[model samples]
Target chain A: MSAPVIFDPMTLPSDDNVNAYTFCVELKGGEWFLQKGKMIAYYGRIEFNGIGHGRFERLLRTSFHSPLHASDWVVAQGSGKMLLADRAFDVNSYDLEDGNLTIRSGNLLAYQPTLALKQSIVPGFLTLIGTGKFVAASNGPVVFMEPPIRVDPQALVGWADCPSPCHHYDHGYMTGVLGGLRSLTGLGGTSGEEHQFEFVGAGTVLLQSTEMLMAEQATGAVPHEPGVPGGGAGVPGSGHAGQGAAPRLPGQLGDLQRRFGL
Target chain B: MLAVDMSGDSVKAKNGSMVAYDGQMAFKKMSGGGEGLRGMVTRRLTGEQMTVMEVRGQGTCYFADRASEINLVSLHGDKLYVEASNLLCTDAGLRTGTTFTGLRGGATGNGLFTTTVEGMGQAAIMSDGPAVILRVTPQYPLSVDPGAYIAHQGNLQQHFQAGVTFRTLIGEGGGEAFQIRFEGDGLVYVQPSERNTIGGDV
Candidate 1:
């Protein structure tokens, strides 16, 4: 067998992938915001500090808007090249030119401080807005598709520049009493593809080759206030009372009585 | 999967890792990793026990474990130090032994001893992903996270470095608190993913 290629400080790629699973980012007295515990190795002197570090108070004010995710991120400062990876997943870096993209919270590995990271309106997603480079990991290779497409929810990595992203249930699976009963009880054959996330408008939709999702990192709970999507407050009938009710499985037809026109 | 062709030779492999074989092969359980009594006693005392088997008279034998990525390392009179759990197979001529690793092993949660392969021939090690071989020189030392480290070869001195400070006590700590600093000339193998180490959270 031939000898494997060895990487050193000078030969390591700057801001590029060292391999399909690992990415190298060179820092010249600069700082990058990285998720905690994603760093594997480094060639030069780099210090990883928690986001709550008193010195980064000014930096967090300008670039970081998601206070809920503060505990999961860190600031890598100083010079040298550092490698980033995530559970051996396929890691890729994308450049954003004054654009906004929303991605699953757990898929994001690291990002430049130039981009402002905020909690997305959609629960369990984070939005990055600005011009910079960010690294993300997917279970398999990422496939980019145009808008006006409905995709399996499990295969979705994220979407960019899209205006509408809503749940799309198959018409046959949601209409009649038989359909509702089948969906609710799984009495008949359920293809497990009855629901998908539909995207419209002009943009790119990112999908992984596989449907397996990375473990979800807790992005922290949203505030309990009105006008919040998953704030768990202000909804009169669907408050904590819903938590006490029987757990509803995904694709379950809600309010069977109402569906029967009772 | 790794396939080794043998006409009338023998190879040491991890026990129960043979997935398939196409030719005549006699498999014998190597009591105490074929290291005899001294090595077995040392490994048992160090808590770095390894169960290996000797496969002899094989045409083509295949070995695999847990669908992990396998990497081959060629040694020419040098030594390769690896975790016992990551070692898959090695040539019959190579000498396998356990060595003290000091604090680096403890921090990685792999005990205070590591398995070492000496002499010539190729040894197969496993990693969570393709292992990145990093060349470490005296001029450019390398600091690696304890969780991602798998193996290393050549002449090297490793130092267990901790970045824990007062902030680490109050729930605010650099996620990468424990690292192994390597100096001298060697090749360090790091997996693309990290294992759960004792100091990983800090």
Candidate 2:
């Protein structure tokens, strides 16, 4: 009968951390269903060099609250908007438009072959050639929203929601050495901050912190105003404690039946 | 050679690793540097195949040939953080740590990381910067740059999509395009703004 006076995850039974900032909520009503909607993303500005370089802190999500069931969502801000259907929820929108939504989740981003799910048009899978070949994936059907979602490097898969399949570029340790050399002589060298993968689509966007990252994060590994810190060559800045085999958090992909609660 | 013109990001660090905007997935050396007197090179390269040799220290440095990619021994310090976005590959890793999942609201771990500062220190140790985090919720839908992302919970459904005309236009550009979009509710970790400063991000 009335729009929620205050939409927030805090109002629900939260089993999360405020500093760690992970919260969860379940729906009160509604049975199983499939949700769909056009995705329009407007990614906010990014912050760089231990500074608030990211534009619009005011854009910080005030209420990370969502409905448990598939509901209709629309892009309410930025350059445009789109209508996603009654299946899932919109996590957080961006400044750019994912443009449109086409496919449902089903092993969309794995090294495994696309499992030909009905009439197929894959929009959630991305393949890129890094030191190790990998794919970007989602948990299930991606929804639409106004502002883009802020993501952690650990959960990001890529940004290539294009028509043609994604290609991987190989650059073994040899190239890293060569690139490392060039930066010294000023021949060529980016701050290593200008790198990004492309994933073009308006499908369900899956993401979460890798288990490996969590291991270190809980200790406040971020560079803060600490006592004079050391500098690791490729690693940079120092305030960490441990050596030998850092943990790794592998990425993943999934499908629909299990995602939308159908 | 389809280079996606890239720019602007006031968000987080998980996306520090970026490719050339002109459209190309080739990994090229961008630059190099070092810690103590030994060998190290820095160059600009493209693609995800490139490996960024990160070093954390406060000591005398040296110059060497481009042959040696990284100085494994020189990464010593209090807490050396490098943005993983540009990192092509690591020697090895393990999914040994905490977790946060489910979709409720504008999640994305509230647009932050899941592990506590003190907790992540156990892992972010020897690494630079904080963990770039992401959260997915029922209401707040989020998409992230793959390269910048570190690790995500293992309950999402990863899929691909086509680009451009898939929406406003039709039947153009050879068949259809593809993209990586996720659904469900979970947290995606990432650096706030800083990235893996390979070559000379320090």
Q: Please report how far candidate 2 places residue B131 from its true position, in Å.
A: 6.7
Which candidate should be chosen as best, given DockQ against the real structure?
1
Q: Residue B51: error of model 2 in Å?
A: 4.1
Q: Residue A249, candidate 1: how far off, in angstroms?
A: 7.7
Per-residue C-alpha lDDT of model 2 across residues A96-195, encoded as one tens digit per residue: 2323222223212111111111212222221221121112123332323221343333344323233322222224211444443443343554443222
In model 1 chain A, the worst 10-residue window by lDDT is: A241-250
lDDT of 2: 0.24
Give interface RMSD, every candidate, in order: 0.6, 17.1
lDDT of 2 at B166: 36
lDDT of 1 at B22: 90
TM-score of 2: 0.20
State, as a TM-score between 0 and 1, how close model 1 is to the true structure.
0.96
Q: For residue B167, give model 1's deviation from the true position in Å.
A: 1.3
Report clash pairs, candidate 1: none
Question: Cα miss at A184, model 2 (Å)?
Answer: 37
